[model samples]
Target chain A: MEEFEPKIVAFCCHYCAYSAADLAGSMRLQYPPNIRIVEMPCSGTIDHRVILDAFEKGADGVYVAGCMEGDCHFLKGNYRAKKRVNYVKKVLAEIGLESERLEFFNLSAAMGPRFAEIANEMTERIKKLGPSPLRRKGEEK
Target chain B: MIVAQQKPLEEIARLINDCQKVLLVGCAGCVTVCLAGGEKETEFLASALRIKRQLEGNPLETVTFTCTRQCDPEYLLPLDNLIGDVDAVVSLACGVGVQYIAERYPHKWVVPALDTKFAGGSLEQGVWAERCGLCGNCILHLTGGICPVIRCSKSILNGPCGGSQDGKCEIARDVDCAWQLIYDRMKALGKLERLMEIMPPKDWSTARDGGPRRAVREDVIIDA
Candidate 1:
């Protein structure tokens, strides 16, 4: 049996998380390549439909990484994203999707190592959860 | 405005589980103002249901539409073409919208995706508090704009009910004693003397006990 490689989508805010990912790349920090990073102007732009659509289209795990609390570029964008992520987690839970499969994180652009750490952390979590139940039969891991 | 809440995703999925295709109707009336049913919500629910069904291996097809006001006949007439192929309809509007769709498309199964909550106003974004009891009468004038019929835990017309303490109801710490609010409001308006006049019991016939009521405006009717 081939080892299961989980497909993860990371919604990275341009001001913080996305820049952090860039810093991590420059710093040469090692992290699992199982995750996909989607850059957004602000994490506050994340929508419930888009996140759920990720799972519907076959993402095993998803997370929104934003600026630290009280540190959003648009004043309260990260706070808005945090609330939205929690709400979507509840919706996922209601549909029998493990709420743990979704997460929200806050960090500054300077946290290069932390960005890599989160990538590795999400990879292990999804690996443990196995493939999403929504994934069709005989599809890629 | 009438406030409503969306039903749980699991329950909505169960309602149309047997069908391969469904029409999710949203209303742009009271339900829209309350954030329960509107174009965005209707689309979101359709996506969620499709995901649920796909996971179940049944693969559902969903068509979403938002009506100007599902409670009115004219708003639902445009759905006639879309109704032809659907096995069922999931109405995201209030209970009135569900019945309207069901009545319009008599041959198809229709279900409600929202729990019609109350006649209320938005306290803030994502929060709503009830304000009216729909008693078919106006009484706010005497109560200084405070309504004990709905705000009061027990609907006490002339009372602090001995359960009011520190301006809060005995039912819960957050619930304000309606009479207490009325007393304060009335006192501020120099109408404290009005409370001394022994008020009679309300007429229950004007309320729900009167059965389903209707209002006819002959001036607005055009004989066809």
Candidate 2:
């Protein structure tokens, strides 16, 4: 059987996570290429619909990375994002989907190695979970 | 505003289990503000239902629409054209909206996607707390703006009941005793004597005890 490669979508806050990913690249840190990063002005701007849409569009796992607690560029954007992520997790569980498929992470822009580590961690997690049940049969790449 | 929460996805999916196509109706009034139902929520629910049904091999099709306020008949007119094409309607509004849609499209099946919670206001960004009982009578003036009818666990009119302790209600420690709040407010206003006056028994007829109430303003009516 061929090894399953999961498609993971990461909504990265431009103020922190996105810049951290750039720094990781500059530092030559190695991480899984499975993660597709979609930059947002702030993690708070990523609504529940956008996250669910990623799953519907064939993402096996989704995560939002934002600034550390009490460090959101927009005052409390990360906090709001955390609350929203929890809400989506509950909704996913109610729909019979694994709540673990969605996650929220907080880190500083200077943590380039940590960003790469998260990429590898999320990728490995999704790989073990296999393709999302929502993914149509022929849609697998 | 009216607060509501969405029903579980599994329960909602079960409601329209056999339907091949369904229309999702969203309300832009109170439910929208409360985050239970709106254009975005309508789309989300439609997507979720489609995904669920597809996984089950039933493969449901959905059409989505949003009305300014479903309780008003005029706002529901847009559904007339689309109602004929769907087998069932899943309303993301409060219970009122569900019934309004059902009444507007009498022959269609209208399912409520939200459980209408209460007449309340947002406590914070994502938290809402009930504040009113909608008893069809106003008494906030006498109570220093505190509502005893709804805030009080026992709905006592005179004063705090035996259950009130340390400003909390007996029903729940977290619940603030309404009379305590009223007393504090009254004291701050130097109107403690207001509580001394004997109150009359509430008129139950003004509330839901009266069957299906209606309010009409003759001044606003123009004979057709």
> In terms of TM-score, how similar is model 1 to the real structure?
0.93
Report residue A64 deviation for candidate 2 (angstroms).
1.3
Residues A37-95 of candidate 2: C-alpha lDDT, one tens digit per residue? 99999999989888888988899999999999999999899999999999888888777
Candidate 1 pairs with clashing backbones: none
lDDT of 2 by residue, B8-97 (tens): 889999999989999999999999999899999999888878767766778898999999999899999999988887999999999899
lDDT tens digits, residues B58-169, model 1? 8899898999999999999889989899999999999999999988888999999999999999999999999999888878988989888899989878898999999999
Candidate 1 residue runs with Cα over 4 Å from true position? A1-3
Task: Report the error of model 2 at residue B13, Å.
Answer: 1.5
lDDT of 1 at A24: 97
Clashing pairs in 2: none
